[model samples]
Structures are given as structure tokens and as C-alpha cells.
Target: MKKIILTIIYILTLSGCGLEQDSYLVRWWNGNIPTKLSDKKEKIWDICFEETKYLPENTKEEKEKADMELNNCLHEKGFWD
Candidate 1:
């Protein structure tokens, strides 16, 4: 029982590493993108777009809204510098 409990705990800890690992969270119009914590502005933006891509069911209007929200979010995060 002890050995099984330790194994289960180890597996759970390893799996949880993939969840909520990103530090910076940006809520956009239709969805949100999270990024690993980094000081590089370009990296943050790249992660945002890469992570927040639309699905097949997403409408064009939703995409447009997300674009506008992304721009606003970037500006608010001071990427304009």
C-alpha cells in the first residue's frame, strides 16, 4: 500500500506540471491565452497568438473580435515599447 501510494503521488505531481504552468493570462474577446512567464515582449505575443488560435466552429466575427482584443491586450501589457 505504501509503495502504491508513493507511485500515485509521483504520477499526479508530474501530470499537474502540464496544467496552469503559464504565469501570464490574457482574457480576450472569445477566449484567453496564457504564456510562460518571460520578460520578452515578442515571446509573450507569439505565445498569445500561438495558444489562442481559433477552432473550426469559431466564426469570422469572433476572430475579428479576438484580433481587436489581442491588440488591446498587447498594448495594455506595454508591448508597444
Candidate 2:
């Protein structure tokens, strides 16, 4: 009985509410974007989504690198706002 309860708890924890609709990468991007990039929000988001959408969110360092790369891509495209 305890094993069954533990299994149920693990399943519930893994499959948290709204996990399908919003990905970890998307949430991270949404939270980490600089305020200066807000004026051109749509295009910035598009670049970010397009460039980093396929990146693996496995570690904090990877995520930070992805964010830096996204910012660099935006700056390279001259999309300052």
C-alpha cells in the first residue's frame, strides 16, 4: 500500500498541472528577457523561440548559454528596442 501511494505521488509530481501547454524553455525565456528588449517584443520573442526552441534544457549552465546566444542573435540582427 505504501509503495502504491509512493508511485501515485511520484506520478503526480512528474505530471504537474499545465506542464504540456508551457515548456521549461518557454518559461525561462519569458522570465529572463531583458526589459530593454520589450519594445520589440514580438520579433524578439520570435527570434528567441525560433533559435532556442530546439535547445535542451538540461542544466542551469545550458539555459544561461541559450539565453546569451538568443541575446547575441537579436543584437546581430540589429533589433535593438
Candidate 3:
């Protein structure tokens, strides 16, 4: 029984370690505006877009700034160019 409990605990711990969050975004430019994004390459673009919705709306500037920051974060994590 003790061995079974230990095994279960070990399995749970390992599973938790495997469930990692994707926290990166890649970007590319097209024409005069930037286009394309890969949030950790998992196709979580909608989630990423939602997360960036807090940007100011005075101009496209705020959105652009957020995109740049997200791109940098992805690059630092070796997930973007």
C-alpha cells in the first residue's frame, strides 16, 4: 500500500511538471503593417489576441507596442524569430 501511494504521488508530480504553459509569440511583417503570429506555435492566436486586448485604442501604436513586446518575449524563450 505504501509503495502504491508513493507511485501515485510520483506520477502526479511528474504530470504536473509536464503541463507547461506556452508563453511566447512569433511575428512577421506583411506590407506596411505586421502580420502573422505564433503563440508558442500551438495555434493559440485567439488567446494571445485576447490577452493583448488591454492595449490602448488611441491609435494602432499601442497594439504595435504590445506585439513587439510579445515577439521579444518569444525570442528570448527560443520560440520566435
Each candidate's clash count:
0, 0, 0
lDDT of 1 by residue, 1-81 (tens): 999999999998897676553433324322556555556787768766665555232789877777886777677667767
Q: Tens-digit lDDT track for model 3 on 1-81?
A: 999999999997887675434312211122344445555554444455566667675669977898876665545556543
Q: Pick the candidate with the highest lDDT.
A: 2
What is candidate 1's CA lDDT for residue 72? 72
TM-score for model 3? Answer: 0.32
Give TM per candidate. 0.37, 0.43, 0.32
Give lDDT for model 3.
Answer: 0.59
lDDT of each: 0.67, 0.73, 0.59
Better of 2 and 3 by TM-score: 2
Tens-digit lDDT track of model 2 for 1-81: 999999999998886754654676556646953344455766776966798777776899988988888878877766664
lDDT of 1 at 9: 100
Off by over 4 Å in 1: 1-39, 54-57
Q: State how far residue 53 of model 3 sits from its true place (Å).
A: 5.2
> By summed lDDT, which 10 consecutive residues of candidate 1 come out lowest?
21-30
